[model samples]
Target: MKEDELHAFLTLQRIPNLGDTSIKRLIARFETAQQVLDQKKESLLKLDGIGAFKLKAFFEKEHRLAAEEELKFIQEHNIDYCSYKDQNYPERLKHCIDGPILLFKRGSKDFSQQRMISIVGTRKVTNHGVDFIKQFVEDLAPLNPLVVSGFAYGVDITAHRAALDQGLDTIAVLAHGLNQIYPKVHAKYVKPVEAQGAFITDFWSSDAFDRTNFLRRNRIIAGMSEATVVIESAEKGGSLVTADIANSYNRDVFAVPGRPGDAQSLGCNNLIKTQKAQLITSAADLIYLLNWQIEEELKPVQKQLFVELNAEEKVICNFLSDVGKEQLDLIALHCKMPTFKVASILLNMELKGVVRPLPGKQFELT
Candidate 1:
């Protein structure tokens, strides 16, 4: 965003009682934060959800000054930001009504992709949880998934490291400002995180770190991803909060079930019992459930030559015929089929000798 526009957004963020939803509403009415800020109090108060109390800080010089200060901090730190309207802003988050108006992103990473999954759980992660995360992330590496987490201790950092070990990008959704890393011990992982992924937050350098910040941060972690997975959690934890937020956003949620007697398992168990999240034991289950698997075996052309395909298979066969040989992932992506379902159909087609798998995981008509 341009400096003047960035300044305007920062100023809007500084406005009290004006939340992301309200700011978005104001934007819809006025087009830009600068436009909204420039309007007179009488004009602003006329809009729905706008009130005198919310606009009490309107026309205040302090807000402008604060925005300028934040902007300077951003520039000095070489920080980057994306407004909600920007093309680079997360697509999933864009659909969230309460997503941050201005999101600050650091490092070489991309959140716009559809493969990101938020993995959150308790700070007191168990041996089973650690093992599960490592094996699961390693297995999920084939999908090139972007792991999202809070970058805290236990499950958060585990997910980050697990993804990193698999050479997959992982994002840290921080509860505090980028100016400082919380739980200072996790500071060691910062450079590595920046190398492979990034740290993102909507908080300003001047914002104080607080417990409630985790709740706010949870929204970003939950909102940006295709799914949220709880590896392990106690009865009450931030991971559950993220799960609830993800469900509210209508995103898929998964929980790793634990033995009934385990303290750390209570939250995930409850989520399954309450039907809030699907149960997933391993990476394959997750891949199948999330439709990330690709079609492997397809029938040769001989089978389709003799037996006509249904409408769906016709779409897939026609697409493959046009594209020549195609990767299953690309086929699924282009044909708009869930990877698992398409894979199964391709397997059936393979048995029929209508399509054949080639070297390097490509599929072509036989």
Candidate 2:
């Protein structure tokens, strides 16, 4: 967007009562941020969802001054940004009713990747949670999906590192401005994350860092992805909030189940029980449920020679090798395994390039 238009958008953001959704309504009617700002109070109040109270600060001069200051900081830092209407704005986020009207970013400035997933959990993550994240990202490495997470402690940082270790792109959604990093200790990972992907936010450098900002931050993490995975979360935590937000967005949510007595497991279990999220034990379940297809060229040429299969996988492989092709239910019935278990195993086998899914849920050895 041009400088003047960006300034107009920033000014709109600075208004106290006007939010993204309300501002969007104004933009739709006026066609541009500048145009909206130029309209008289009587004109703006006539629009649906607009009220006299919202327009009380609409013509304030302080907002325009704040926008100028923020614009200067943006230019000095060489920050990259995109308006909601820009072509490069995150495609999925664009559909969110309350998604930020403007997003400031650093690093690659690319939102082109179609296969993005956000992994989130409590800041106080368990060892088991860390292991799950590492394995999950590694197993998903072949598909080369972009990983998105808040750059905080525990699950978020672990997910980001796992993606980086696997040479996958990762985006860190921040609660604060790009001027500084939260927790300060995580400053070390800044450059590495920027090199691999980006750090994006709607908050400006002048904004104060507050706990309340995290709720807003979580929305970006949920809004930018096709799915959100809760590796571990307490009964009440920000990760669960992200899961709720993801569900509200009508996006798929996956939660890893934990032991019955574990405190961290309660949130995930509740989410699953409430039908707010689908239960996922492994990356295979996500890939299967999402119906993400492996590229033909990316498939391994020799499955048995290099890939290792467990007892159940070997049984499925042998059965498919002999039968040529079979449906999921028939394979499960003949193999004496539960249909859900067989489904997960088949998905794992598909990832290993040992088999390929066919029409009507049939599977054939590759």
Candidate with top lDDT is 2
1-366 per-residue lDDT for model 1 (tens digits): 789999999999998888999889988999988898889888987888877788788778899999999999999999989999999999999999999999998899977656899999999999989999999888676557899999999999999999999899999998887899988999899999999999999999999989999999999999999999999999999999999999999999999999999999999999999999998877756765765643332111334446767888788889988989997778889989877567656655655567776755567877
lDDT of 2 by residue, 1-366 (tens): 999999999999999988999899889888999999999988887887777777778888999999999999999999999999999999999999999999999987399999999999989999999999999999888788999999999999999999999999999999999999987999999999999999999999999999999999999999999999999999999999999999999999999999989999999999999999999998877876887766666545446677999999999989998999998889999999987788878877876678988877788998
Q: What is the C-alpha lDDT of each candidate?
A: 0.87, 0.92
- Give the C-alpha lDDT of model 1: 0.87
Regions more than 4 Å wrong, model 2: 298-310, 347-353
CA displacement after TM-score superposition, residue 96 of candidate 1 (Å): 0.2
Number of residue pairs clashing in candidate 2, backbone atoms closer than 3 angstroms, sequence gap of 3 or more or interchain: 0
Q: Candidate 2 clashing pairs?
A: none
Candidate 1 weakest ten by summed lDDT? 293-302
- Indicate the TM-score of model 2: 0.94
- Once fitted onto the true fold, the runs of candidate 1 whose alpha carbons sit more than 4 angstroms away are 295-366
Worst window of 10 by summed lDDT in candidate 2: 295-304
Q: List the residue pairs that clash in candidate 1.
A: 298-350, 299-349, 299-350, 299-354, 299-355, 300-353, 300-354, 300-355, 301-354
